[model samples]
Target: MASFKDFNLSRKVQDAINDMGFEEPSPIQASCIPLVLEGKEVIGQAQTGTGKTAAFGVPIVERAGTDRRVQALVLTPTRELAIQVAGEFRKIAKHKRVRSLPIYGGQSIVHQIRALQQGVQIVIGTPGRVLDHIRRGTLKLNSVQMVVLDEADEMLDMGFIEDIESILKETPDDRQTLLFSATFPSEVRRLSARYMKKPEHVTVNRGEMTVPLTDQVYYKVLERSKLESLCRIVDSEEVSLGIIFCRTKRGVDELVEALLARGYLVDGLHGDLSQAQRDRVMKRFRTSDIELLVATDVAARGIDVDNVTHVINYDLPQDPESYVHRIGRTGRAGKKGLAISLATPREFKLLKQIERETGAKMEAREVPSLADVAERQAEVWRNRIIEAIQGGSLGHFRAILGNVIDEYDPVDVACAALKIASAGELEKREEEDYNFGDTGAKPGMVRFFINVGRNANISPSDLVRTISEEAGVPGQTIGKIDIFDRFTFVEVEQESAPFVYEALRKSRINGSRVNLEPAKPRARR
Candidate 1:
């Protein structure tokens, strides 16, 4: 738990860490930084979300002389991680006035080439692109004194191991190498044995689950149907602030666009955002101005929001440790939180591993039905009308209604007038649910909770019909319904909760919109 100052970091790096609100070093940083600074080849065993970036980052910034000859190179498994690690390096180097550029695919290779021509002291890139640059004669590692393999195991998993070795061959023979990963799999061990010179091994064990408060669940979704299923869940549930984790930056951008078309207040975060854009998005998310954040794994790291009510895995993570970090966003400060993951058949093995490692069972759930969506929309209207009635502030509209009443049969007129007043609120939501139908789930069921019950003038049929219409979850899969004075609960598959939550958030009952947070244990009998 030593501070950066204790580590004797340069004034510039220390100031930057302070500005970023970093106080004490994490265990990995505490152990690895010293070894790295001593010019030793080191293997760091650590999980994501631990501050390993700064561990090797500090020494590289300090040791990499400002001769501007590609003094350091950082290789990562994916483009997103490469960009992120590069950003961290630039922040530390800002005070020193050093230049570090990130090179990755799906970006303009010409632009990266131009930057390389302009003379960057450090380069960060994915293995494929880095090797591409090397073969194209754009990147020269002749002057490199330090090289880092961030997430070595991930590179192995993604079949980037061969590219990684080729990238290493280009660096100076006398250079320092640091390899970091959650697990040192056999391939990683082989790579180190071949490339590293008797590297010092540093392992830091995770002490306790920081996210014990997060209520975690999973939906058994198919690879093809996940998008629609996710939409239904979001429509049915009442989540305040949440994040959806996608494996790639491309996936993040794609989902953000899809969610926006469906009328959810959302934004995207990933390696593609400029530093300024990243800052702005985070500000809005933190201020509660935006309810949903779609992000890739690398871009979502270092995010420490405590109020996130939910974390959805739009794509499964590469490892069990990442699962822990993703869900850690919620259930903070003694408050209840939730995590829902969407898993396809091929990804179930990884899901099982995550469950085994965390000692938590993820409940399987079904897709929501179309009936569930409509019913939920109606409830939304009911709550709106009730709120208006109870607030007692319709003085201007009262005269207009009175005139309409005089012109028609009193009973028929009254019923028609009620519908007119409720139409506008219901219309906006109506267009929203149906327009996103393609994004709705197939016939299925899920479990959920309602903020209203018998005492508050609600019933099981009301809950069933509401969830069915809004989330597209069927009434058949909707299981035992429990009603209480101030709340109601229903049992459905765990998979359908996201869609159910989405529908419920938009739906209303009685005069008050029911607040359907993830239930605590079971609803009160």
Candidate 2:
């Protein structure tokens, strides 16, 4: 319950904390910040999303002098984490004018060298890149008074233990070393024994890897039906902001494409993306421009956005630690969150392993049915109508209703007005119940074949735009889309299929003549 004000920090540091809207110190921050400020070598054992960044960052920023001689060095396991930690340092040091730079791979080292020449007080980087800089004589650690090993266990798992040792050797022996890891494996202990000078150990929330504020659930789904199940849950739950974790870059891309094809506002993040691309995606996600982000486990490291309402595991992680990290993205800062996992029958063992490791029971949830989705949508519509009525802005509409009532039965007039107001919702519900044919499409939708596909370099967004603009079909009404090598299959509402088909039949996509027709049913085996 202690506040950052009680830390005896300098005026500039306190001002920065206040400006960042931090009224209190998390448990890790409360315990470690004071020790760090006192130049104590402290070992912090805490999971992700526990505000450990500020615990180390605040003191690093405060202790670093204005001379800007790279006095503090932070080593992370991944480039994303390096960038994230450096960003935190920069934010906390804004008023104090302490400079922190992130050095990592996939970036121009020449640019980093130029920045180093300009002077920087704090350098946050991955161990590999940091070692490269030291070998090149570009990063001088002789003046470094403090060193931090964030996510030390992850660094070990990534085979950076040797590099970390080398980096530690270059720094001054009198430097304070702070090591933080979610789990205290033997390797971390060895590292601390070799480098840390009697570091004080602090552990918080070690028993439960998963946060209590998050509602955890898992669904038993077939591999092929996972995408359909994901869509159903997202639609039924009305997830505003969420992160979907995939097992690989290819999975992330495929899921992102699937979600985009369904007209969901989403993007993908993986190791293949450039730093600039990653930055742009994160910026948009943070600003709520993107509703959902599909990311691989390695790519999502150090992502600390707080507004996420849900964390979905599209693919069960290979290990329990990854599972914890994926779900930890949500339920942050005491906000309630939802974590869902889609698992195939074969993957159920992995789910059980995660449960055993985390010691948290995941409630089993069924895939939402079409009726369930309709009910959820109706509830949302009803709430909106109630709010509008409560706001007293419907007076003009009431007068018109009264005029109509004078000519017809009041009940009939009310029903007609309700129908007009709820037309879109009603149409959606009716479409969900409509069957397309023997193509095995989802109810309420019909599948259509389009000539343009991946070979034409057409993306899901392009297809959605073409259908919406040329075919006059609303984007939301479009369902799943599968683009093959030479053609694409798209699902549209049963009622809108004809309009979309006819509109695109005579049109051109990417300057090529387009062909559109209902998809042929496949022969059953």
Candidate 3:
């Protein structure tokens, strides 16, 4: 429960913590930071997403002098994790003038050697790569003051025991060691006992990590229509905030792109992003500026944001740890949360394994129908109208309603207003018709005129993003758009025109007010 300030860290480390938006220390950090800061050997037992990185990172960065001798070494199991840990060091050590580099395979070892030659205070790398550097004499651990064995269990599981031992022997025996793992199997414990000097044991939420309050479920989806089905579920469930997990970096990218094009506020996290890019994306996600995030498992480590109403597995987890860690993101602090996964028929075996691993049954669900989505939206719209009425600015609309009530039955008028509010979705038929009369439009597209085009310095992307963002329609469905000096003519598909029209009418482009309507032809001219 202690704040970051309670650690009595240097001003630079404190500022860097603030820069990373650490409003407070997490349980792992709270338990481990002080002990690590005291330069004592420590062992931490914590799950992923428990802020373990910063627990060790803050002390390492704070204590690491500006000397360029690689004073700290962190060993991770994968190149992805090495990069991610290095990124966290860069952020935490931002104001401390401590430089860290991630040396891993597949990347240019020559570049890593050059960076190391230039003198970095910290080195984070996979065991294979670190050992390679040591054997090549590119990395010298004589001056390494602290060593971190992150995810020790995973490293041993991957058969890195010999490499880990060789790498550890290269460091000075007096160096402080910090070992962290989700579970301490006998091998991990033995490794710790041999290397660490009377380490203090620190465990958080050891046995009770299951998310009992979370409702676990899965939907059977066709491979081709997975995105469509996900959108339907999103519309029907009305998630306050959600994180969708994909198995690979590419999967995260593709899913994020698809969701954004469908007018969702979304972003992606993967190893492909630079530290700064990842920071920006995460900052936005934390502030709720982006409501939905798509992320790979590694990139989502240490994410402890609250009020995450949903955890969606766009791709199934391959392991028990990944499966449990993903769903545990929601259903925190006694708030009810839901975890859903999309599964093709071939993936049922994987799903059953997850059920057995987590000791929780995943309810099977069918992909929500379009009608179901519409009904959910209408109910949300009615609730919004109720809120507006309670918040009292509704008197302004009362006069407009009064005028309509004079010519029609009050019930009919109210129903008409509700239809308008819902963009006529309630009355949608198999054909899904919208009567955009007398407008100059192609057979399947409606052309609309927009005020302030080139004159307002607007671009087609701006228009597309705005229309799609405001109207909740797919950006890909928008047709051609022509820009003029003072106005623009844009084409939209017939069904989405009304919603797009209404959304734009109340918005602005390039600080200029928007006035949008169906375009008319000048036939006589």
Q: Which candidate is the best by lDDT?
A: 2
What is the lDDT of every predicted structure here? 0.76, 0.85, 0.83
Candidate achieving higher TM-score, 1 or 2: 2
Q: After superposition, how far is residue 106 of candidate 2 from its true place, in Å?
A: 3.5
Q: What are the root-mean-square deviations of the candidates from the true structure over C-alphas?
A: 14.5, 13.8, 19.1
The sequence of per-residue lDDT tens digits that candidate 2 reaches over residues 182-203 is: 8888999999999999889988
Error of 2 at 14 (Å): 2.7
Q: Runs in model 1 with CA error above 4 Å?
A: 206-309, 313-338, 342-353, 360-525
The C-alpha TM-scores of every prediction are: 0.58, 0.72, 0.56
- Give the runs in model 3 whose Cα sits over 4 Å from its true position: 206-231, 238-310, 314-320, 328-338, 341-370, 377-525
How many clashing pairs per prediction, in order?
Answer: 47, 1, 0
* Per-residue alpha-carbon lDDT of candidate 1 for residues 18-76, written as tens digits (9 for 90 to 100): 88677787777888888898899999986444667888888898876777689999887
Compared with the true structure, model 3 gives a TM-score of 0.56
Which candidate, 1 or 3, would have the higher lDDT against the true structure? 3
